[model samples]
Target: MRLFNTNTARAGVAVIRAGSLDRSDELDVPVHAWVKRKQPWLVLPKDAEMFEDASTMEVLFKLFAR
Candidate 1:
């Protein structure tokens, strides 16, 4: 999942993988609430490895800048 914190040219992106999370993961309640609120704007790709390459991430960043 890619969570974009902003929709403007200087948007910040965070990448989260399903495998990287577990039930025991300790995320703050407010932060989790924020993520839930931002869920609609998140990019959830079917293929988890799609953005594993640096080039792909760079391309996405450039696209966001535009």
Candidate 2:
């Protein structure tokens, strides 16, 4: 998440939170939203795509290759 924020700060690129849209792990915790609340500048893409339970690299490529 910090990576996203840092890159956005320096490069002005859109932030895409790939993988599970729930932003939580198997533990059912609200991880992404929690981080967003803490770092309000961490912008989430309006078209953030949710992926099935799969490899993160797959999701990342899917997101970036657009």
Candidate 3:
């Protein structure tokens, strides 16, 4: 097994602080479906620009910034 070092852990914290990573499982299909069922009025943004594999830092920033 492997373990993370201080710098590695710090880097991860920095990324979270910068809002570059999505820690919530909100975008997960099952979770999304459940939330939608619970709150039918709630809506999620949809766009042709949606992608499966990659996204820009600005997108990630907007998504995780809260």
- In terms of TM-score, which candidate is strongest? 3
List the lowest-lDDT window of 10 residues for candidate 1: 28-37
Q: How does model 1 score by TM-score?
A: 0.20
State the weakest 10-residue window (summed lDDT) of model 2: 27-36
- Across 32-59, the per-residue lDDT of candidate 3 in tens digits comes to 2123233457455553345443345555
**What would the per-residue lDDT of candidate 1 be over residues 1-66, giving only the tens digit for each residue?**
532334344346654543456753464221122233344677643433332323244555554576
Best model number under lDDT: 1
TM-score of each: 0.20, 0.22, 0.26
Q: Could you tell me the lDDT of residue 48 within candidate 3?
A: 31
The local distance difference test score of model 1 is 0.41
Report, for every candidate in turn, its global Cα lDDT versus the true structure: 0.41, 0.40, 0.38
Better of 2 and 3 by lDDT: 2
- Misplaced by over 4 Å in model 3 are 1-49
How accurate locally is residue 29 in candidate 1, as Cα lDDT from 0 to 100? 22
What is the model-wide C-alpha lDDT for candidate 2?
0.40
Please give the lDDT score at residue 5 for candidate 3: 23
Model 1 regions lying over 4 Å from their true place = 1-11, 22-52, 57-66
